[model samples]
Target: MKILNRCTLEFTSIPENVAFARVAVAAFASQLDYTLPELEEIKVAVSEAVGNAIIHGYRNRPDKIVRVNVTIYKEGLEIQVVDSGIGIADIDLAMQPAYSTDPERMGLGFVFMQSFSDRLQVDSSPGKGTTVTMFKQMGLRKARARAN
Candidate 1:
């Protein structure tokens, strides 16, 4: 895919940065003329991906680094959240709804990410951490074309 614009952010795996990542991605996504609801969906999906990296991947270790890559394209927006901490041994089981390792938490991060974005992909190695990549189409062209 051709990238029209791209930015990368690396920050400590702290809970606070989750909101930062969400807002940053939303701001970048705004260039595509997304509706307010669409922007909210992007923010929510980004928060889930980043939060998962902080809580599950790094175990709340503030020293760990989480990276976010945001790319804008004519087709849509592509965002990736990556962490270099403990990775999932069983991706299939991890992706299952309500299958969180933490009993107190409802494991619906993947569900929300999948629902909010046009595409979602999870990649991980047992000791190499995980990467969550998602894409959301602007859908502006179609709407604009319809008005003509």
Candidate 2:
């Protein structure tokens, strides 16, 4: 697949910005003619990833940055979100359904990422921060089976 488009944005660790980030990603996914449900899935997954960066990665420090990079390709889209916050000590724990380092959140972020996209990967270290990568493929007017 060819790379069609991409975008990168740095956001402050604020709750309001969570919805803002979701809107941005949703808008970009729209260009691909993703179904409404697919777009919602993208928005939720992206929001959770970005929210993790702002909360766990940055520790609400306010000074750190949550960098979101989106790439649109012939098959679909890819995203890499990076943050200089406290990295996850247990990738497995972070991924468990309803798991969370924070109490308020239900810890569905990683779950949503896995549930919504064709692929999701996370690279991180205790001090080195974290990078989350996600991929989605846009098919014809009708949905099609993805090739492995």
Candidate 3:
């Protein structure tokens, strides 16, 4: 896909930055002709990815770094959230619905990310870190409307 625009953000792995990441990505994505609901989905996906990076990847360590990269294509957009923290040993188990490392948490982050995006991929190793990539295609609403 031809790249139309792109941006990279690096922030401290703090919980407050989740909202910042969400709004920033949504704003960048608005350059496309996405509807309001689609934009909301984009925000939710971003929030979950970033939140997971800070919470699970970094283990709530604010000193760590979380990076977010967003790229826009003619067809849609791609979002990547990366953290250099403890990585997941079992990606398959982690992606399962309501499965969280922390018992207190709901573990629905991946579920929200998967439902909102056209595609979702999680890459991680035991020590390397984690990267969550999500793709949201444009004009999905129109296609769904026509189908119904």
Task: Name the TM-score of candidate 3.
Answer: 0.93
Which of candidates 2 and 3 reaches a greater lDDT?
A: 3
lDDT of 2 by residue, 8-117 (tens): 98888776788988899889878777889889989988988988898888877777778889998767888788887778788988899988878988888899899988
Q: Ranking by lDDT, best first?
A: 3, 1, 2
TM-score: which is higher, 2 or 3? Answer: 3
TM-score (all chains, Cα) for each model: 0.94, 0.89, 0.93
Q: Candidate 1: global Cα-lDDT?
A: 0.91
lDDT of 1 by residue, 21-58 (tens): 99999998898778899999999999999999999999
* Over 4 Å off, model 3: 140-148
Q: Model 3, range 1-148, lDDT digits (tens) per residue?
A: 7788999999999999999999999999998878899999999999999999999999999999999999998778999999988999999999999999999999999999999999999999888999999999878665355335
Q: How well does candidate 2 match the true structure in TM-score terms?
A: 0.89
Native-to-model Cα distance after best TM-score fit, residue 91 in candidate 1, in Å:
1.0
**C-alpha displacement of 47 in model 3, angstroms?**
0.6
Index of the highest-lDDT prediction: 3
In order, candidate lDDTs are 0.91, 0.84, 0.93
Task: Report how far off residue 138 is in candidate 1 (Å).
Answer: 1.7
Once model 1 is optimally superposed onto the true structure by TM-score, how far is the C-alpha of residue 95 displaced, in angstroms? 1.0
